[model samples]
Target chain A: MKYTGAQLVVRLLEQQGITTVAGIPGGAALPLYDALAERGSIRHVLARHEQGAGFIAQGMARASGKAAVCIASSGPGATNLVTAIADAKLDSIPLVCITGQVPLSMIGTDAFQEVDTYGISIPVTKHNYLVRNVADLLQVIPEAFRLAESGRPGPVWIDIPKDVQMASIEIDALPEPGRPDTAPCVDMDELRRAAELINAAKTPVLYLGGGIVTAGASAQAVMLAEQAGLPTTMTLMALGTMQSDHPLSLGMLGMHGARFTNYILEESDLLIVLGARFDDRAIGKAEQFCPKAAIVHVDIDAAELGKIKRPHVGIHGDVSQVLDRLLPLIQVQLRKQWLSRVSDLRSRHPLLMPGLENPRSHYGLIDAVASALDPLQADDAIITTDVGQHQMWVAQAYPFSRPRQWLTSGGLGTMGFGMPAALGAAIAEPDRTVICFSGDGSFMMNIQELATMADENANVKIILMNNQSLGMVHQQQDMFYKRRLFAVDYQRRSDFVKIAQGFGIEACDLDTAENPRAMLADALNRRGPCLIHCSIDIEAKVLPIVPPGASNTEMIGG
Target chain B: MNMRDSNINRKLNPEQSGKAVLELTVRNHPGVMSHVCGLFARRAFNVEGILCMPVGDGAQSRIWLLVREDERLPQMMSQAGKLEDVLSVARHGADHRVFEKLEEFFG
Candidate 1:
């Protein structure tokens, strides 16, 4: 059979089980788009911006735990996708990004719509390729998938020139589809040492990160915590790994964590770090964070083991496999004294939700939204958030019970992430209700996606919290910068309801509703794609905030 | 990175006396060198001297990097090894004259 490079790409993607793709088309990638049109099996969700397309694919990957694909043309199209690709790198989301390049002959001539996609993406992607020949597609396409979904998954880019995409080649059969390599064999001695450390430690904390979800090891992580009677704290990316109400679950740690959680971490004797990099945000003032704890850091990536805080037992292996072997070696202990002590601390300095009784207030608004479609009750909602105060409010108050249920950009903290990601989640899980909690500042960044959401009629209910200012920045400037607020506040407030309606989406305002709670529920319950706008107090802050360069224990408010 | 000058680059200490050389076996491709060098440049780790040439069948290349033996050198080597085109990375004493021999040519 004869196949064009574009056709082969589509076939490889089909073989990889990609039924949906999100992207925009331009000159260089016309052939790829044409091939997709001819096949007619892969449904394309047209995004308003390339960045939105990237986040949409991220949503699909983060929700499904599979490598998802995103496409863009060369030059600006490729450059726009850089942020999302970099986000995937930091968060370790699996994505295969394909872009079109100028013809090989035109590459060095500063051809129209030509930018160095391969060069620009090298620092951000796990790996990248610039396909020079049509035949190379056979190897490069499958290899891209393999690398993207392999150990310590991340984004991979494949930049095929326009000429290559139009070129044809005869082949007997397509190569086998790509699969992730088997995880590296873990050191048994390290596992033994970890087990010994856990068994011997009087006070141990199991710190889970996003890798737990990627490795499909949530159950194992919870089991490890229960078996060893270890109090568990989650990084922002690992919010849903342990159920919020679990006896030992410490919601989230560091930065905006509960005062008690940080205090407990400060006193722990040993820390069993799994699938988590000790990020600056998660481990404030590293030298002062859990200073007394002997860390047992286990990650699939060897480079991450000592990249931040060094570990007493550094085990480089997949978290799931390590837990599988280590579970049997562990001695089941109740550690009643430590449990009681933790309870006492939690009771004294809990996460203070001040405005939780009034729906008009920030925390109360999040609480009301959760009450509207309680995922804990319905078992079918995927919550996503944009960066800033609203994201933190949801992270702090939303009842996330399972991994993938919470899909926020925890690492890169990109602003315009929520709406498109919500659309992608809705597209991937049509039956599940997807809610995007966004701030006015973040919402405007990708407000154009509302048109796409309306076109698809994606089951997304965007609860936009309009503050008219970047609340986090305002708070920081107020506290840290002596109230020298500069570009944080918008001089003109946007009417988001009218904007949503203009984009053909159903929109309502809680500010005008007499009973906001009932109105929110009504809007959320009957949503194909709707925007529920609620004005927020600009002065409200996401409390228990650790100052930038201070230790977690130095948080000023709760 | 010059961790000796900054406290944030902790654990990845740069000791002036502990200079070393890194030899990498990589796939002969356009961007493989960028991938390796970008990793160092991101951390501001300087490569004082460098040499690269296609090996036996021309399908692969060997790159020798002259660098300070930062405490984070092991971690950096592991990161380099993770690159798709990098096949192997070996460390040698700074006395290795691979770059030394190229100095006259560069001059």
Candidate 2:
């Protein structure tokens, strides 16, 4: 059988069970797009920009816990995808990004629309390939998927020249679809030691991160917490790993975390750290963080073990596997004294929501939207947030149900991630209503995706918190930079409702609504795609912020 | 400044030469070297000397690096090992003969 390289790529993607892809077609990518149009097996989402396409792919990957694909033309197209790919790497999302390159004959002549996509993507990707031969596509395509979604998933890039895309290949049979490499075998000694530490410790805390979600070990994590009578705290990435209202749950910890969470961590003697890298935003001053605790860190990637806080026992294995073996070894305990102490700390330094009752306020807006959509016990909403004060507030106040229910740019903190990502989530799961909680500054970053949303008619509701400024930056300037506030506040307020309507989606302004809560219900309930804009106070801040370079215990405000 | 002088500035006891060698076995691919070097450069880890030769069957290569030993060497080694192209990493003292033998050619 004969197939062109472009057809081979599509066929391989189909074999990998990729029914959908997001990308922008360009001059270099024309042949691939032609094959895509002809093949008609895959659903191709036409994004306004290459970056938007990349994030859409990321959204699908993040929300579904599956490897997703994105495509781009060479040169500027590949450059635009750098942030999204980097974002995936940092957050450990499974992504395969394929870019079109100049013809092999053009090589180093600085040909039109040509860029070293493979070279540019190296640091940002887990692995990258530049296919020099048409025949190599058979191996390269499957290898890209395997490397991408394997243990400790991350983005992989494959740059194929235009000539290669047009070249023909004859094969007896197509290669098998790639799958994730098996997780590392857990060591019994490490498991016994970890269980022994948990069994013996009087004051133990279970720290969860995004890896918990990736490993699908949330049930085990929560089980261990209950069985061991351990207090649990999640990083922003690990939200929904333990339900927000679970008794053991201490909520998100570190910068912008609850005051009691950090305080409790300080008092703990053992920290069972699972699948979480000690990111600066999550750990604050590394040396000062959990100073009293002996840590037992378990991660799939061996490299992450000693990279951050050195663990007393570092287990390099899948979190689920480690927990499965370790759970039975742990002796059940109900630490009444520790629980009583945690209760005392919680009562003393609880997370304070100042304007929570006011529907127009930051925290209130998030809560109101959540309740208005799925007020009952039904869990039908997927929440994505752009990075800002709004993101933190949602993290603090939103009642997350389970893992993969909430998606946000946790590591890279890219501003333009929310809208396109929400669209992609909606595209991936059409029955679920996807909400993008975006600030004015962040919403403007990929506001063009509103048109794409309208085209797809995806079920997405954009809750725009229009502070008319970069809220997080403004708050930092106010607290740290002597209130200079330069470049943080926007001089002009753009009418987002008008903009959303102009993009051919339904729009409503909460500022004008007599009953904002009712209006929220109306917009969310009847949403194919809609923008709900509400003006928030510029002075509103995500409090309990651990000032940069300061210890988590030394947080300034709440 | 000598190694002892710098170690003194950092308030640590100076070790012998403060140098170490790393030997990496990697897949022989066009960008494998760049991937290895890029990890070092991005993390601000210094590589003092470098050499690579394709090993048996031309499908794999062995690379040797002379680097100033620091507390970050373990972390650097872990990061290097995480690269897809790299198969294994072995650490040696600065006295390793790979770079020592190449000194004569340079001279």
Candidate 3:
């Protein structure tokens, strides 16, 4: 069958087993859309915003473990996909973004609806190509897919000039993606030294990071953790690597992490950090972080080993491969005494819920909301959070079992990220219940994402913690800013339940505990999308905050 | 200062083997550091760290490289030069004035 360059891209995607696409058609990209529309098998999802499209693709990629595709037209459409692309790049989500460009002749001339998409997307994407010739179109498709999915997956951009798309091409076969040879060499001697450290330390803590997930070494990580019987705590990006309910798992580590995780990091004699960098968020004060511990940093990216905090033993290679070689030589012994000490800390700082009798407290409401979740299947449900007080609450309360189930803007504390990300997550994993935990200020950022959910009929439950204020900022101001509420008060009384209903989404309001649990359970169990608006106290505070420039020990909450 | 395209075919025999140079233009940005290094990753090409200076009205930058023979020279250089803030791209070696002085001095 004869095909144009536009049709070949779709054909290439179909050949690679892509069953779905998320995009909006504009004039410059109409031909490609026309080709897609002509194909009856591929499911195309229309996203309200181009950024939303990219994120939905991201969600799909994250859930399905394959490269998800998103498309956009020239100018603003292509530009709008930038943030999600960047997000995918940082988080290492595999995505292929196909964007329309102005005709080749008009590229540098600033023609109508044109943008230097290839140039603009360079830094944001893993690999990108501008199809200047029709003959290159076929090669660009497979190359983009290869680059996006191989060796630490990331988003790749293919900016196809309109003329190239319209041009006819005789393609034989797509070029097989060449293997990248960039991984840093691992020295067996250094690996043996790291193993020696693990074997010698009595109170060793495994601080896992996003690298484990990026390296797809969760199984290997589990083996290493279980074999050594060392307790594990993960960074925000490392959530879902170890089942939250697992005996050794201490959920998220760092500022908002479990008290036990921090205490262990502070007291442990050794820290075996896997695929995790010492980011400020994870290590509150770099100089003081893990001061007592001799760090064994294992990662694929050699640059990350001692870039932030010094590591006594740096093992560079793929986490899975390195762990495979190291685990067998180590002795199997549980650190029972250290584990007992950590458990004691866990009880002492158990999420710090407000006293039950305090009717005005927001913590009770948060706990109650958390309690309403289906405890039996809670592990299966995915929780996505926007950055704020609610995010900390969810991190502390929600029990996430699997890796990649808890999605948040960890690398970039992007507000308004939760709702869209949840919608994307739900579309990606249709069977699993995807929940969006967002505060009023955060939910307002990309509130329009609700329309996208309603349109897609996604099984996403948006739990808006309506505090009517920027809770985090308000709490800081209430404590530090002399109670000078200033502009933190979101006193504008807007009824979200009504607004959601107006948008044609199933909506409910929970003001009383009489049936809150049942209502929540039912809402999460619903077939399509639903919104649960809770009237939370505006002055609520997420405590244990280490004020700016202060040490971790100087936390607001005892 | 020794920057030339590394795409030219080279003899595989030990007696004929020699180093080739590559010049790359990249956008001046925060993470451009990694993006530049990543180009040489699996190409059997070793890049001695880029010697870069601000150019193109302070918006763009040029990366000078002393590289070994690699097949991806054109693709890598073009890809790097296509970065957001990149203005233009070219390779300079013994024939170019800037690189010639350095080549002569090293020789």
Highest DockQ among the candidates is held by which one? Answer: 1
Q: Rank the candidates by DockQ, best first.
A: 1, 2, 3
Model 2 agreement with the true structure over A361-433: per-residue lDDT tens digits: 9988987887788565237689999999999999999999899989999999999999999998998888888
A311-407: candidate 3 lDDT, tens digit per residue: 7888878887888789888888877887888788778776566643332245554555455666766667888888889888777666667777788
lDDT of 3: 0.75
Chain A TM per candidate, in order of listing: 0.99, 0.99, 0.93
lDDT of 1 at B100: 77
Candidate 2 C-alpha error for residue A492, in Å: 1.5
lDDT of each: 0.91, 0.91, 0.75
lDDT of 1 at A110: 90
lDDT of 2 at A381: 87
- Candidates 1 onward: DockQ, in order: 0.44, 0.38, 0.05
- A best-first ranking of the candidates according to their TM-score comes to 2, 1, 3
DockQ computed for model 3 against the true two-chain complex using alpha carbons: 0.05
Q: Estimate each model's TM-score.
A: 0.97, 0.98, 0.82
Write one digit per residue (lDDT tens) for candidate 3, span B1-107. Answer: 00111223233344435444555566665445555665456434577535677677855667777654344454456555534334555654423444545666566
What iRMS does model 1 reach?
4.9
* Candidate 1 local lDDT, residue A520: 88
